[model samples]
Target: MAQLGNIENLIAARELLTSSLEKSKHLASAIDKTGRKLEEINQRLPSLEAAIKTLASKCSLSEIGRHIDPTVGPAAAVLNVFDAVHMLEESLSADPCSNLFRYLSIVKQLEEALKFLTDNCGLVIRWLEDAVRFLEGNAVVDDDRYLLNLNKCLRILEELRVTEEHSLLSGGCLCAAYGKLESEFRRILMENSFPLPMASSSVSVGEQACIASLPFPVPVIQKLQAIIEKLTTSNRLEKCISMYVEVRSLNARATLQALDLDYREISLSEFDSVQSVEGYIDQWCKHLEFAVKHVFELEYKLCENVFEKVGSDVWMGCFAKVTVQSGLHDFIKFGNTITKGKKDAIKLLKLLDIFAALNKLRLDFNRLFGGKACVEIQTRTRDLIKKVVNGASEIFWELSVQVELQRQSAPPSDGSVPRLLSFVTDYCNLLLHDNYRPILAQVLEIHRSWDHAKFEEELLSHEVHDIIKAIELNLETWAKTYEDTTLSYLFLMNNHWYLYKNLKGTKLGDLMGDSWLQGHEQYMEYYATLYLRESWGKLPAMLSEEGLILFPGGRAIDHDLVKKRLEVFMDAFDGMYKKQCSWAVSDKSLRGKACQLVVQIIVPAYQKFLQTYMPWVQQEASPSRNTKYSAERLKNMVCSLFQPKLGMYGSNTCTNMMGNINNAAINQLSSTPAAA
Candidate 1:
């Protein structure tokens, strides 16, 4: 019975053990099923999160658009949304999932805001257009509101592009939006007109000055600049700056054309205006260059494109226009300025002013472009020189005519010949070689061996050649004016001698040169010879063979006939003395020489007449004698014939002739029958 009860206990313990084992297997299978379901639930979690992210993106986008108050102004609504998106972007950034959705929401709402700006806020552009239309019609209108809205729209668009890369919807490029804003901005600028800057200021300083009416007048330029700033901030500078540069360049060109630079009217007063035409052009250039450089400074990559498109054209075309127009009137005025107060209002012709102007122009152009620009105007330079010369020539012709008239109205002794010649030579000296010293030195060095042809060949210019010819012609005309050959010769001799002596080391000497000096010396000699023949040649004719007294009755003298012949000769001497004493011989040496020549001819013949008749002189000792002029008395009278101004040289010739006469008288007495 105990064994059977223990077996039952064992069987019950076995059954309990088997039941525990089966329950354990069931619990293991249930744990396996739960693990499978948990794995499946874990696999579905990412999809749920993705769905939540998509929903959050839509909701965030809805919130952003709702917060944008359309009732408030469009610019204000866009500003509110832009501000909200920025805060959301910062707060949600730690969770990439939320951040991604936040960024998408920002782009979507910003796009719609930009669309509002494009469609509804286009009233800003319309206002700009109206302002431009008013300006185009020659009436200025305020555009401050338009510009402000434009700036706001551009600001929002730029902020949107700056958000995360995936924020923008499909086909939404910030650059494309930039392109639209830039186009409208440029259109307004193109249509509007602004006055040239009228203040006296430098380029850098002027750029800081506000146009009292329009501080940022050219929104086209300003908008383009804003776009460049946006692109450059986003590191997309090179991709879009070139297009902006090209558009800005085209606008600048159009503005230049509208200014009518080519048809600009310049006058003397305009040239002399306080704000010169050049100043106006300078202001224009500064405005254009500032626009170009401002854009370039926003992105350094734009420098080359800016210069190629607009900078070079501004320098060579628009800048060149200012130079050409200003130079035209200014050059003529420059020529006129120097020539004032001159003889006939034309005597002083100098190219120095023109040369100085040209130099200034070159330096100004170099400075304008910082020595990087090149322009050619050689033909214009030549034309300027030609105009000066031609204008001067007209004045010269008038002066020459005046000189001729003055000379014709006066005698050779009036000094007009010398004065006019001096003026002409001095003028040529200053004009031809640019200085008078070289001409002065060259002329003073002239000598007998100087060659005329060689000297003329070395002369400065054709104008100089013509001037010298005129001088020679005047000299010839003045010399030939005197009726008496002796007086004519005297006139030429005095003038030529004076010129030759006084012109040395002077401007006239240089102009006349060595050959002229040598020729003058020859002229002096020729005239002196002619004077000798004229004054003295007639004295010998009075003592010709026909004039001789022949006493057929050797012992008796024909007292009346001999006395009459002596009186005839004395009367001729008196007449000759009276005439020559008044005639001028300025040089002391020349006066003495002339007196000696006259005495040599007259005294010898007179002595011969006295000697031939003196044999009968002592025979007829009447108180009123036929030969009344004793040798000593004749000598004394002849010495008194020359004017006191002739000095010792004029007296000595007569004194020596007296000695000859006394010796001849003594010899005649010795040969006579009375002395033997």
Candidate 2:
């Protein structure tokens, strides 16, 4: 049984081996067939890739065609690309301006076609370029059918650009569109732009707030921005910008005109006097401030809003052109006119006002005209500042010249402060006001810095010192006019006292320092002392006891000599009282002090002389005739000195009384026996 099972197993094994051999044979045949197919495919791969690239290029054309006509099949569209371009050129050649949107659509289509040609037709373009180079005698290239077709397409595009009628479809159409847009931009700006509410003298906060807001409505700005974007895209933005500058510049000028600042028509001849020029200067300051603060500021904001999409350079340039054309040049020119006009002392203050206005607005100038396009405006503004500074300096120094020219030969007989001194003090006071001190100081500093030694110190003190010195010299010159030594002293005293009192605690005083006050006080005191010594110093010596008593006779006084001395003393006192009573002491305290000094010096000497001599005179027949004034009466007379002389009504009474006293003294002296 084992043997028989072994035989069967061997037969099974044989059948299995047969089945495996057949399967292996089939696998070998399939592998051989697949390897042959792969070899065939590998040999055709290059041509297949070329066909795919050609298909892609055609698909690109189909994509463009789909954008134009959706019903066309891809193959038909690719075949009709040149025909479609030619049809678009013909459609665009008609009045493209009739329908701007339609015109823009055609332009966009051309642009798309141009992009497709540039991207996919590089080889064809290179061939054409070489052909052109060949035509230009640079090289030669063999032509083919493919090159010819592409050349036809390129020629259609070139016709759209070059043909007189169709050129409008390309750059000319867009230019016309932008030109219309520019007109629309102008209309929009003009209609929307209204003059800001202007204050005649100053800009109120409300008006400033209004000016700070956008000049145009949001819709208008958006419209302008849209037009600007179109122009920018078409590379024709300069026309739009120029139109904007022109319109806004006229608007700015109109705004100034509304403020009554017709600067261009203003002539130097109109300002015939300092007063007339002063009125204009005030207007100039107000108008300039308004122009800078409101008009130019509005223009700057308008530029920023309209050209926001454009660069800062574009906005800044536009703003600068508007500012220049908006009468800023004429405004500064008017200021220059004033500076170049006749130099007057009062012009100094007006020029200083202009300087201050410009100085205050300097930052605004730099902000508005900061670009290179507005360099001339900036330069003119700076030059105006320099002119103002120099003009102010010239006028200031002329104070001294005016003083030197004041060659008055007679001082005021009232012995009060001189008119020149008063004017000078008042002028200096104005110059040293808080509003004008720093300005004048800066003017003086700049002037001194240019011509004088190199020093960086405060110049107001030196300037004030020079002016004071000139005034002092002038006072000395006038003081010499007084033939009365006493009156001259009194004149000096009054003026020096006035200077000290006027400038004691003011800005001028601060500049003059404490030494100035002390020096003037000393001058007043010195003048007072000299006035006393010259007027009444000899009265006491006239009645001196040394002359009354003979040297060899001990205690033996001459009665006749004593009486003669008394008569001479009375005559001298009467003359001095009559003369000095007319002179004025304007200040109450100064008058009292002067009266007291005269009393202290003259009264005691007169009283003591009377006390010593009246005894000898009483022995005469009638002492009453000799003693005309008692000590009490003499003190009263001394107290009455230095009071302003009576007016016309009181003068008659004083003159009659003085005449009666003189007649009584003369009768009594004549009636008395001759001294022996």
Candidate 3:
């Protein structure tokens, strides 16, 4: 079994060796065939290389000669470009101001040439940029010299572009041309622009006839538009825009100045009084309306027409510059000055007028200054409106403060209406007029909304009520200044009557309502009664029957006692007449009623007392010696009590009259038979 296994292993090893030898022979044969093919390929290599070289040369030559003019070679084309650049430089050398149309034509040619170069010479531009980058120390791999050499046209272009002489001819000359265009733009604008007509006194003239149309003539606008197109094409739009702003701004300012709307030159101190500024305020309103509605409106139209092809931002910037430089700031500044000036009740009315004027023009302001470029104007205008609203509101509330201050002043000694009272009532009357009522109502409503977080339509009425209440309190305080209770009551009656009489049938009366009117009426009546009671109510008591006695069942009268009472009554009547006669009631009807009240209280009582006792006293003496005042005389004296006895109430004549009356009363009393 071992011998047979050995024989099988030898047979397996021989079969494996035979299979390996067959595979090696096939491999050697394949290797020999591959080497033969390699030798054959090597024999054709040089000829194929020579053929490829010929094809590459032909392709390069074809690419270089493709667009070459048969008559004008690449060299001539380059020279032609240089000639075109030289011609552009020479054309730019001519002043644009001399002939702006001709100059603009030349600039248009330059723009077209630049655009053509940019479109056709992109690769040359990149190469030149790369070369410039390498020169500037940036890493860059240079392209092949043959490729670079093939594009001689583009290479020359790059060379011409980098040269200082070409730069001066192209960039520098074009800049000078743009500079000339800017000057021409300014000159054309200045020549064509004219001041707008002076504003009419009437504000209802919404805009001037010229404002409805373009301010510039058609030819001038076209010329300006042409110049703008050239400048825009050259990417010099900012220069043109700045020039337009400068020229047109001056024109707008001139127009406003012609309308007398140059508020910056004005001084508030030029006016003699706050009231004197009313005319200026009126003028301000009219001129401001004209400026916004006419001058600026025209300017906006001009900007739109001239820069219509330009972007809105550019035109808006130009318009904004013109509007601001043309005294719009000064107009608002003037208003601010007025609001920030002296605070007074009268100034409140002025501020309301200013507010109304500005408020009226709010839509115009928004329309004109709505752009981002006019943001400062919009903000300042809104701020001024706020200032006017707050200032007018503050001054409106100062009515109460003024009343409180008036309380410190002396009351009218003649029991007439206090000046402060009349001032307040008159001021309120003005405020409640048709022109100011709605405006003030709106202002106060907004003010309340800001301060109290609430709004009410009756806000103005409430404010008026508060002011009236303050005036009433002040009247009360003033009344106390009079030492005589009668004059004090008379003072209250006079002021209340004055207020009611002046305010009746007016808007203010309607606001105060019937209840308020009735209340004031009752107040006047109550004070009138007090005056009568205090002045004459006690006179009747002096004649009362308590002190008198009838002896033996009224058959005999006590003559001594009655005579002594009569003497005392005469003395009291004489003293009261002298002292009370000087006090005055300024209102006619009020004075009449007041005098009648005194007569009603004392005259009937004294007359009846005389009817009973005068004859008893007369039995001892004549009537003249027995009684200084008869019923008729007492009635006459009472009727004359409230009349102004001298010139004016507080005048020297009034003082002399009081002194003379007192002296006469003293002399008459001392010489009387009762005193003797």
Candidate 4:
């Protein structure tokens, strides 16, 4: 009996191996066949160029502009476009990653060129027909050459449509390809939608701005960009609606899972099944990945389509649209959420997927980690993951055994994600503050990889340094003066806002730090400290008043120099976007109100507040600078000034999303870095 059992087990193992291998082989074969078919299709596409040349040669050459050669100039442009469309089709037929995101950038240019030609194709052909009829009658010599070029264009159009039909059908498959693939798939889709990343990049920033030198008029670029803005707004609205639906669905599912409906105590059967909870995890992973694929795919397509319609001019267009009171409002909303719990979301998603994979593996095999086939892999994977997650119960579960005193009356925070988010946001706003204009310039220089040393030499002046000093001083005062327990939140908000405002105006790759927007979320929990529970004052008066803001306890800050520097800096920033970037601002047709909000608000309210109020508070120390005192304190200032507290709070109040991000990030840096 023992011998028979051993033999049976060996046979079962062999059968499993054989089945896995066969499936792999079948997939491999299918992939290869698809690749060959795609290659065959691509080989047949460029033949249209030959047809274009054939037809063009049949017509007499133009005396004006050269005759259309299917492969060069506009004809070449047409030929290249058709050729590209064909190749993109072939590539998608094989795999989305075959050429990666390469063809995406060209797709927009091709579409626009094709549409213009397609619309005029019949007209060009009709004109040629008329010219040919005149030739039979030996008519006017004036229009012959013009007719010849139009005839060649019509031929190029005829050849283009054949490929166009093939491309549209082939490109549709890319939706599925992208929905399934990872790695550059979304970016590729965006490239297809908007091909402006290239042209806009050519516009050198600072004094030598190439954007001003475009052969196309500035208004043309602006107009093109506006159309794209509408496209993007529509796309974003649709995506937001879709995302809300997904979030709502996910929330509903979670509610169902947490029903515990017999609410008295937990049921043993339902609880017992959770001992092997990986099964539920695995199920969620499958569904969630599917959902992400769809969501990301949709977002990519939406953005891409917008870009294509707008060209490189989209950012300029975005600059205009993003400034409307409503646009700025929505941006702030997203900025707030991103600063809240992006990290926690990323962590939980990965954890869920891994646990799900582990569960599915265990069910498939009686013992995965302990077995000869899986032992080494499972052990290695577990150790690596354990190190990364570091005490998983703290991250994943609240009910697990713990020594630390958990908050007493608060409902399990998993359910109070918003409040928990508040804690996280609060800490950030109190910690991370940024120097916007300087940071923006530095990041942009980094992005352009221009003469960094020279750029800094030219960009940073004594005035800029003074502005930095003044901003830093007041910012430090804000960080130091407040006795509020939730002071850290103020830091987080400013930092997030400053980063977005400054950097968003510049191109990517200009900043020294990673664009946290790319992959790893800025961890909200890092900012999550129990604020109200801890009775810490916002900033010590010692640090706020006497302590130099710049090198607070570290170096000397010339208080006089700081004031003048800041004034010059603020004036420069005021003009930077004055005539260059605004459109909606009835004030100036410059650009970027995002940066304006931070600079204008931060400079006056916070930067100059200490400059103004601190002197009034300390009557003996009052001397003269250009700074004016607006009351000894800001206590009744809001009431004295514009609108009194309209919200529930008698003092100024924020409606969560109505709060700030730039201040939050600034708070993060100030509280921690100097403390070190």
Candidate No. with top TM-score: 3
Which residue segments of model 3 deviate by more than 4 Å?
1-72, 84-102, 114-159, 162-172, 199-213, 259-280, 394-408, 518-585, 588-676
**After TM-score superposition, what is the CA distance of residue 138 in candidate 2 from its true location, in Å?**
30
lDDT of 4: 0.32
| Model 1: per-residue Cα lDDT over 157-190, one tens digit each | 4444344343433334543433444444345434
**lDDT per residue, candidate 4, 31-118, as tens digits?**
3453344345335435643543454446443421232221123333333333333333343444434443333322333344344335
Better of 2 and 3 by lDDT: 3
**Model 4 spans > 4 angstroms off:** 1-77, 93-130, 136-156, 159-244, 261-676
Q: lDDT of each prediction vs. the true structure?
A: 0.43, 0.65, 0.66, 0.32
The 10 consecutive residues of candidate 1 with the worst lDDT sum are 667-676
Q: Residue 81 of candidate 4: its Cα lDDT? A: 34
- Which segments of candidate 2 are over 4 A away from where they belong? 1-176, 199-211, 215-219, 263-265, 272-276, 394-402, 405-410, 444-453, 484-487, 522-676
Per residue, candidate 2 scores C-alpha lDDT tens digits across 246-306 of: 8889877777777676654566676643445566677788778878888898899889988
Model 3 TM-score on a 0 to 1 scale: 0.64
- What ordering of candidates by TM-score runs from best to worst? 3, 2, 1, 4
Candidate with the larger TM-score of 2 and 4: 2
Tens-place lDDT digits, model 3, residues 1-676: 1222333443344343322324434433443453344345446545544543454445443442222222113222333333444445565777777767766766665554443343324433443333333223322135243333334444455555443334426457666677777878888887787776543545443344433545678788888899888778667788788878888888777776665554445665654333546667777887788788778898898899899898888888899988887778888888877766566565677788898888888899888899999999989998888888887877776566656665676777777775455556656767877788889988887887778767666666777778788888888888888888877888888777876776778777788888888788888888887876776777777777664766545657667677777777778778878877767776777778877877787788878888888667666647678767778887877777677645443221212322222222122111111110
In angstroms, the error of model 1 at 482 is 1.9
